[model samples]
Target: MEVTPLINYINRIVTLTPEEEIILSEYVVYRQYLKDQYILQQGDVCKHANFIVKGCAKTFHADNNGQEHIIMFSVEDWWASDMGSFITQTPADYNVQCIENTELIQFNHETIEELYAKIPKLERCFRQITERALVSSLKRIVRNFSKTAKERYIIFKENYPEIEQRIPQYMLASYLGISKEFLSKIKSQLAKETKS
Candidate 1:
């Protein structure tokens, strides 16, 4: 698969000279996964930082009751990984699963380290990306604690318009920390309001 999307994302943060781009490209590996496939399972070390080139995936963890809670969804041009595990080289508490047949460009830890050594600007690029992701996660946590289910649902739809259509209603409910029935009611209310 062409790595234009990944390269484009990098260029947005820091300009990459042709030689630098070539060096970065040397470390990228392309992979395809079928829908429902587990890219990173709970207890397994997350070996790569995956960028979705096509399709969607989710990061989630199951509770002792075997109930799963979604942490986030990643669509085309977005990333999905257990960052803690990827960085620490330890087992992950969450799972990253493909929601559709997905194509990804992945960079393994060793390759990333090599890129950092060979192209230091690339290190800054990734650092910025990770920092942004961390901030987004913190904001979501705060919103989940403070926002009502309806409000959270609306915000989720607004933030993930592309993802909203591709995932199942129950999965969306899980992401919003609400029940499927409640989500259905929320949608009905929104539909009526839209019609009036």
Candidate 2:
């Protein structure tokens, strides 16, 4: 896979000189996960940070009752990993699973550290990414706290127009913190409003 998006994302974060880009590219490894595979199982250290090239994946946690709640979804051009596991090299409490067969550009934690040492500008790039990720997570927390289920659904659709159709309703319900039946009811209400 051509990792153009990952390169572009890095370039946006820091103007990577040609030599820097080449050095960074040397560390990237391309991998594919089949549908339904767990890219990062709960309790395993997430050693690699993945940049999505194709397909969809989700980060989720399972409750005591064995129910899963999705924390995040990643599609093309997005990155997904267990934050705690990647940083600490500790076992993660969450799982990252491929919803569809996925192609990803992956770089090991060691490789990232090497990049930081060799190209310090790349460290600035990751720092910016971390800040943005934190901000986005906070915004999602606020949205979950303040928005109604229907409203959250609308917002989700607005924000991820491309992935909305590809994602399953049950998974969407988990992400929205609503029951699947509730999501069905909301869809029916939307249909009723449309017919009138």
- Say which candidate scores most in lDDT: 1
User: Among all windows of ten consecutive residues in candidate 2, which has the lowest summed lDDT?
Assistant: 1-10
What does the lDDT come to for candidate 1?
0.92
Misplaced by over 4 Å in model 2 are: none
Q: lDDT tens digits, residues 1-196, model 2?
A: 5767788988877898888778877889999899999889998999998899988999999888989999999998888899879999999889999999999999899778887899998788888888989999999999999989999988988888988788898999999999999999998998899899
Tens-digit per-residue lDDT, 2-22, candidate 1: 888999988888999999888
Q: Against the true structure, what is each candidate's TM-score?
A: 0.97, 0.95
> After TM-score superposition, what is the CA distance of residue 4 in candidate 1 from its true location, in Å?
1.1
Sequence-dependent TM-score of model 2: 0.95
Clashing pairs in 1: none
